[model samples]
Target: MRTTDTLNVIAANSRVLVGPLVLLVVLLLLFVFALRVGIGQIISLSKKVAESKVEEQVLSQKLEILKTSEESALPLADLSLVAIPSENPALIVISQLKNLAGEKGVGLSNIEAKQTAAVASIFHTEIEVTVEGEMGSLFDFLKGLGSISPLLTLDQVIIRQESGIAKVDALIFGNFAPLPTTLPSITSPLDELTAEEKDILAKISSYSQPVFTEVTPSGPFERVDLFNF
Candidate 1:
């Protein structure tokens, strides 16, 4: 009878221990799950913070560019001839051509201009020039014309050697900006140029200005019937 009673007490102790053991296992599982969730949240937050930092940096760079542009605004007087409005684009082109030819020792035999159709806000004119000079001087004259203000586009160039002289026939296109009714505001993005752009502007500015002569007032893009053979 005493052995039977000892067995019953041992059974009762195991029953009480089983409840606490199960509770401990449940608590361990809860702790592990909480740890995993906390780690995942931390990783997600870190990525978000990194993205925000990148976005902030990009915004700052754009703001800096805009600030620089505003600080370095250009005046109308300092603008290139192409950027300014022209009353007589053909006259400008003739003057520029005359100066370039004189500088390069090239003789201009004939020059004729015809107004082409306008495109957008700009008007276009076509010029044909016949010139005679040494081969080297002809090339130099072409190069100089390219660097001059109020940029000219060489449409076609034909060079031939005759009697030890280089004869050149060139077709060029000139762009004319329309007159502005009112002055543009200072907030224009084109008001400021980058360093590379400024370098180009400087090179063009170093060229000698073309001298204008008094000529009859002719409208922009007037049709001319002069033929150069």
Candidate 2:
């Protein structure tokens, strides 16, 4: 009878401990699962951070490129203002000359334009102008032409005084650049000006102005015949 009683007591103790052991096991499994989920979230966040860093670096590089482009654009804009387009260069020259002559109280008698041979990717256009004005006004007009756009070069000048008025025949040359099909590659923005370009600009600025001011024309001047040769 005592053995049977001891066996019953031991069995009852085992039943009580069984529930607590199962609960501990469940808690341990849940902790393991939560730890695994946390680890996965950390890894995903790390990957995102790395990708963001890479994108930030790429954006920085793009910003630098934009800065360089901005700097380069300024000089190119200045150059384009003086560069001649591939359009009707003769009309442009004639109009510019007529306006300049009228401003300086000069009379434009005739103008003739001829296209010369291309040299070094640049096309040359020759303009022959016959002008009559006072000697001082004629000199001033010639000087002002040097400072004008599309860059004129006075190849020859013949001047004679007729009845106290100067009659001048000038052979001027202008250049036009052909339109480029392919875009040029520019690596840096801080490029130096070429020697030839510097020299040309210097010459243009070195022209002397006349001591006295000539009266500008009040009305439109007489139109001169423009012939293409």
Candidate 3:
């Protein structure tokens, strides 16, 4: 009887232990599944971080390129401005006049410059000017101004005699075109006349001499044989 009782108690303990062992096995499997899911999420986050870094690098490179382009373009724009004649049409006209007239002993007084449509459709602008000078000097000056590379015109001429001196007034026009055939790049006028521009001015110095030289007396007229009025 005692041996049977001991066997029954051992059987009951084994049944209880079987249920606990099955529950432990199920819990361990759930924990392993959760660990695997967490690892997958970590891998996905790492991939996103890598892709973001690549995007960041691409944006940085683009920004650097933009900066470099802006830096280099400034000088190129300046160069283009110099190469275009239309940028400052008035400047070319004034400069050419000053240079040419100065060389020819013709003083510029009451100069009037205006912009008009260019003679050729290809040019951006044409300058028209009204200038005053001595008649002999102006004739020579006109001939020289015409000798400019692109060509200049003596549009109109008016003459008046003032105390035996001939006063000349003329309107000159010209279209300054830049070489190397490019779209008009500059939008402003010429900054100042260049040395090359001054060379062409020598032409203004030439004048047609009158038949007789005029002599003027300062204070009073005297019966002088050597000098006469």
Predicted model with the maximum lDDT: 1
Q: Which of the two candidates, 1 or 2, achieves a greater TM-score against the reference?
A: 1
- TM-scores of all candidate predictions against the true structure: 0.52, 0.51, 0.36
Candidate 1 lDDT over 47-127, as tens digits, reads 999977877776666567667655343332354665333654777778889888888998997799876656788776889
**lDDT per residue, candidate 3, 28-143, as tens digits?**
99999999999999999999999778777766665665576555443344333333344435555566677777778876776666655554543443444444557778688767
Ranking by TM-score: 1, 2, 3
Taken over the whole model, the C-alpha lDDT of each candidate is 0.75, 0.74, 0.59
Instruction: For residues 15-34, write the lDDT of model 2, one tens digit per residue.
Output: 99999999999999999999
True-vs-predicted CA distance for residue 214, candidate 1, Å: 10
Best by TM-score: 1
Estimate the overall C-alpha local distance difference test score of candidate 2: 0.74
Question: How much lDDT does candidate 3 score?
Answer: 0.59
For residue 172, what is the lDDT in candidate 3? Answer: 61
Q: Determine the C-alpha RMSD for candidate 3 after optimal superposition of all C-alphas.
A: 19.1
**True lDDT of residue 154, candidate 1:** 90
The alpha-carbon deviation from the true structure for residue 120 of candidate 3, after best TM-score superposition, in angstroms, is 4.5
How high a TM-score does candidate 2 get? 0.51
